[model samples]
Target chain A: MTSKALENGRRSKRHIFHKAKVNRSHAGNAVVFTCILILGAFMALPFVYALGSAFKPLNELFLYPPRLLPQNPTLDNFIGLWTLMKSSWVPMSRYIFNTLLITAAGSAGQIILASMCAFPLAKHPFPGNKFIFRVIFLSLMFHASATAIPTYIIMAKLHMLDTYWALILPACASSFGLYLMKQFIEQINNAVLEAAEIDGANIWQTYIRIVMPMVKPAWLTLMVFSVQSLWNIGSSTYIYSEELKTFSYAVSQVVAGGVARTGTGMAISVIMMVVPITVYLITQSSVMQTMASSGVKE
Target chain B: MNTNIKLHSLQKRRLRDGITGFLFTLPFVVGFILFIFSPVVMYLAMSFSKLSLNDAGAMVFENVKWDNYINVLFEQPDFLKRLASSLGDFALRCPAILFFSLFIAIILNQRFHGRALVRAVFFLPVLVYSGAALMFSNDALSNDYFKLLSSDSDETVNLAQYVISVLGGTEDSPILDIVSTLMDKIYDITCSSGVQILIYLAGLQSISPQLYEASSVEGCTGWESFWKITLPMISPMILVNAVYTVIDVLGNPTNTIINTLYSLAMDSGNYGLSAAMGLIYFLIIFIILGAVFFVINRFVFYEENI
Candidate 1:
């Protein structure tokens, strides 16, 4: 009877501790809630600022005190862009077409080529495998900015400077995508691949069927990254023809067109930003997975 | 003799796998060499040579030893100063980026109302901060923003100055100077922290709840549990985020070296000096990465229990 009483007394003490913990957490929750609310507002401010400026008329854009919201909203900026394009040497639709084609081709090419390289590098124990991967990691350390002049020189020699291949091909050679894909592929169980091999599936069959399907999340993550980057490529120093220029390049030109083009510039930015934001909204969870697995663990 | 026969078959299988690997990596390797590696080697060679256009407008290079490197180091007015300023900004920004992202990630990890919407809002920067959109916004909006702030007679600008002064400072005051710098850079800081927050959130979620529960059972408070459990477990991610932040911060559009190099090569027609500047800047980056990799490798914790 005494032992049972002691157990009851301990249970009551634990319950009291739980009550204190819950009270403290309620206070902690308030503090956390305020911090997140302020931060979320700060984070959302730029999008709001951009959106507001996009809808503003030219006069409102220069208003004193610089209102975050437009005093007078209008679609004239977008209409102006369309009209401006109508007067230009190259048709606006062509610029749009060029951009869409390049983004689609570059991203799709990068994903496929990176995956192909990543699969074998991740799964196979072959001669020079470690050495090849090390070279890639080392290349990541070297900044590509400094190489622009020589790259231009080499492109001139190859006679590929003005071609669409100049833009697409160099981008496809990126090691970042390959690195990300390789990391994801390494996490796949070897037994799964072994089972396919035992069933008489060749290496190609295993990669296309088993590996590709298993790493779908990584595929989407890479897709988000590639599409976003390809969309942002502004001016290529190599591509001089107006017809061959990207939509982003055109948008930058519109921005540089002076004070009259201010509203148009804002509209173009909003249009450019909205697509990637939409994609991220859909694939947020998977992108987090990609980033988590990105770290090189010991 | 039997063991030798077994080893022979194993060797054959290894050679088969090796060929398969080579074939798979062939496309990327070829592209890498043609596009990435060749330019890098050409840049190195061009740095030591005088490059000029011929009568036919074709390029010709004549070897010119250490002249380019010496000129960049001693003669150029803007090269080293720009590099130092960029490095200083990098130092100031890295800690703030790490601290806020960690703080935001922890809060986001908590069960809160409309968490998904909040996450989408925060992640907006990662989407918008690249390409033409970012350039446009940075150029167009910042022009308007600066105009608003600098108009001395305006009420909002006046009120802002009043409040800033109340927080305490004249033009040369250090406390107010840091505050103003932070205020100016607030947008950039928020934008860059988005991906870092997501990475930290993933790290936070990967921590098993049972550990938290056990710590609570042992009478640890929330703050105490965070220090003892959350910090140690996510130490690896801290290293990753630090490296990622370093790359991203240095890779912004207005990077001084890139701007200076472009002007030197194209406008001023000084190819060799530009190439030399590029090589020195690259070496600085290499040294920085090596140091970070060494320091972080010592601290990053791996989960052994799994």
Candidate 2:
């Protein structure tokens, strides 16, 4: 049957399926392309606009009927932002260091811990596994802000308030990464694990050496997610000290300079946005691969 | 004697596996207990108490029987009103996001030029709009700028209104109202559906080409095959995206209910009242998710061997 379709020269070498309206007609293709182009423009608008606004001179920033791209671009905002950073009480590098520390620790801990927990839950059917999974699933429904007060109280009780742990520990405990890793782990072939077991590998050995390597895409995706969230950790309910504040918190402080510093504020926003987008760009393929198996099964 | 020895070894292995599994999950268990479980309990307690700060800025809870809940539910109608409106918005946004993402995903899955670039563009929001980035992007100045641009586009909106009227639909017609609401929220819908589109694209790629080949051989058109093959195969992702969309929309910082709760806690310093409101809001979300899961579970097609 496929041979007949192939003989008709309808199948494109690039695509998997034979073309029998499966690949759209030219008009349909044009429509789809147009739709994609339009939507893509809308999706990219905010970043582009922020970039343009950051480059706009102070006089052009508040122009009525705002242009999508700045008419007169300048590096005054970047210069101003640099000058402002130099004048800060806490060194600008300190804020960057704090953000890097938190992002690195939080992301590493989240991925390692989530992958560790997910392996057992996915492969081993131990007692309380289902209940624990359900609890974790239910926890995902609770927004972080909703639980902020209690988390603050708990942190205070632990004497971890105003410390980096306040940010990193809670981030490490997030359930979404675990859930995602588990879903991906479940897609692994059981026979491979069994083969590892037959080689006298214990559960930990199998998890570390075999399962972990097999689920690299999952961990990569998880890393992107964890880094995205951690990189954006601004003012936390728990952390109060100046030195402990993240880069985002610092940028927000610059933004809080009000109307006069609008250009500088936008420059900071653009810088803040670039890091995660770069991470996503690097791991785009792995993230997409992991997402292929991200569906929830009954 | 040999069989008995084999059984004994099997039992020993089972015990070892159980211990290993438990050990593996210990970090999460401890973290969950300390961070999630205890805080949830404390928050529940706080909801039923009057929360005040002492001289040292320590939270002191004075037990108050049902007062906070009563105050949230009855004395102030704002919470409930916001909750209802948020839910209404969720109902509209969730389906629109799902449909838009799926539509985009289908286009993205097709063989095309600049597909990688398009995919990256679609997934950009997953990074760009998350957490603090969103907070920065939605700052007062940017919002004002966006508002100015939107107001400048009022002529286009008026043209839309004229076209609708010419089509014999009043501005206030239910269908036209929905269309206009969706039109206004197109940017928001586009931003939020990035992850959903990724999920859908993933699901689309995972579907076997042989199914399409067989379907075409059996005289199925692309449209027919899509409904017969694509929709059912993608139903699981649909369910996942639906639940995610609901949670995302509801838990969004810009959500009115969330904002109301934040203000009640932060500005008004009504911690007990805010906790009560949060609990109520959580319950509503929980129920809605349960209903979504229940309804969608019935139609979700899970292939056993896929």
Candidate 3:
């Protein structure tokens, strides 16, 4: 009876400690929440300020101390931007069309090509596979900016300058995309591929039917990355034709028009960012999953 | 012998696999050689040759030599200083960005309400910081902030100055120096941190919760659990994020070195010098990355959990 009482006392002590732990966690929750909220606000600060300024009138664009929100919000800036574009020689719609065409085609091509190359590098045991993979990783070490002059020369030689090919072809064989996809594909179960092989599916058929579906999350993540990168076609310096000018290039031109065009510049900025943000929101969870699995092994 | 027959089939299978792999990678290989490799070779040659644009706007290489390299390395006055400052800037900002990202990732990994929304908010910057969006948003914030600070119309004292006065530190005190330098580039700090934060979050989430639970049962504090379990488990990712961040930061088009190269080639009509400068800068970056990989590889831990 004495031993039983002692056990009961210990159980009660443990229950009390658990209760305290729950209470302590509750207190911690409040602190953590506040910290996250502050960080979120900070992250959103510039975008918020720009969004506000986009709606503000021209006179209010550069107000000292910079009001967080416009006192008298208006859609005039967007209207003004529309008129400004309407007056341009190229017709702003054409710029948008060019951008969408180049970006869509380029990004799709990049994803497909990168995935194709990545499959062999990730799963196939071929001669020079390791050497090729190492070469691709090493390519990532250098800045693409440093290659601009030579790339310009290459495009010129291929007669691709002043054409959309200049923009699309160079971006299609992305080393980083290949590396990312390869790392992700390496994590898939070998058993699944072996099973497919036993089912009499050829290499191409397996890659198309089985491997693609299995790595849907990864490719979607790649799509998000590709779309963002392709959408941001700042001056291709190679593509100088007025007809080939991209929407981003047009916005940059207007934004460079100085203090008078600040409101319209902000409006253009908002328009440009909206698509990528939506894409990111939809794909981020999948991105997080793939990235966690894709962490490089030492 | 029976062994010879089995070896013959094995070699045939190997040949098939190798051929299939090559077929799969064909398009990428073709494009890679044409677009990347050829240009890289051309770039190296251009660095050692005088280049001029003909009336037809085609590039012509003449007088093949290392004069461009010599001129850039010794003749140019501002090249070395700019290189030093940019590298110094790169070195200082990387640790700050990594530390901040890791801190935010730790907090974000904890269970909380509206966690998805918070994560999205943090990630929004990454999505938005591209092309025209980046141009306007960053310019808007930093431009306005600078105007406000320099206006001197308000009664509010400078925050950094006030802190300095209170602390009574000399001009070169490490703390004061870092703070003052950091104050100027606050916009860059906030903008460049989004990707690193996502990376760290990925690393943190990959750690098994069971490890933490077991540590707690062993009478370990949260701090102790983090140091002993979380750090080692995520060391591989730390190295990945570090390499990624370094490359991303250096590759930014707005970088001073890149800007100088653009002006040299486009404005000053010095393509050869620009090419040489770019090559040298790239070499320096490669060396830096190699050193970083060497250092970090020693600490990276690969788990056999899978």
Whole-model Cα lDDT per candidate? 0.73, 0.76, 0.73
Q: Estimate, for each residue in B222-266, the C-alpha lDDT of model 2 and write its tens digit.
A: 778889999987786787688778788888777888888888888
- Highest lDDT: give the candidate number: 2
Name model 3 segments beyond 4 Å from true.
A1-29, A188-218, A285-298, B1-11, B54-58, B109-111, B133-187, B200-236, B298-306
For model 2, the DockQ equals 0.34
Q: Write the per-residue lDDT of candidate 2 for residues A1-298, one digit (tens) a residue.
A: 8889886665454244445354556678888788789778766665676789889887777764345578878899999999999999999999999999999999999988888888889889899999998888777777888778888878888999998888889888878778766765665657678788889999989898887766665576567778888898888778788988988888878876667877886787778878877777776555444334322222
Q: Write the per-residue lDDT of candidate 3 for residues B1-306, one digit (tens) a residue.
A: 899999998788779988999888889887887788777778788788888779998668897698999999999889999999989989998888888777777887776667667877887666665544555433333323322222222333333444465566454467776776565466466567777676566556556456777787865656678899888866765776677777877767667887798789778878788888988988887888788879986886554324
Consecutive 10-residue window with the lowest summed lDDT within model 1 chain A: A289-298
Better of 1 and 2 by TM-score: 2
Clashes of each: 1, 0, 0
- For every candidate, the chain B TM-score is 0.74, 0.78, 0.75
lDDT of 1 by residue, B1-306 (tens): 999999998788778878987899999998888878888889889899999999999889999999999999999878888999999988888889999889888877776668778987877767665543455443423312332222222333332343455455454457665665566576567777877776676566556566787798887767788898999777766776776677667655457676787778879888888888888887787777667768986776555324
B198 in model 3: Cα distance from truth in Å? 3.1
Superposing all C-alpha atoms, what RMSD in Å does each candidate have to the true structure? 5.5, 6.0, 6.0
Give model 2's share of reference contacts: 0.42
Evaluate every candidate with DockQ and list the scores: 0.38, 0.34, 0.34
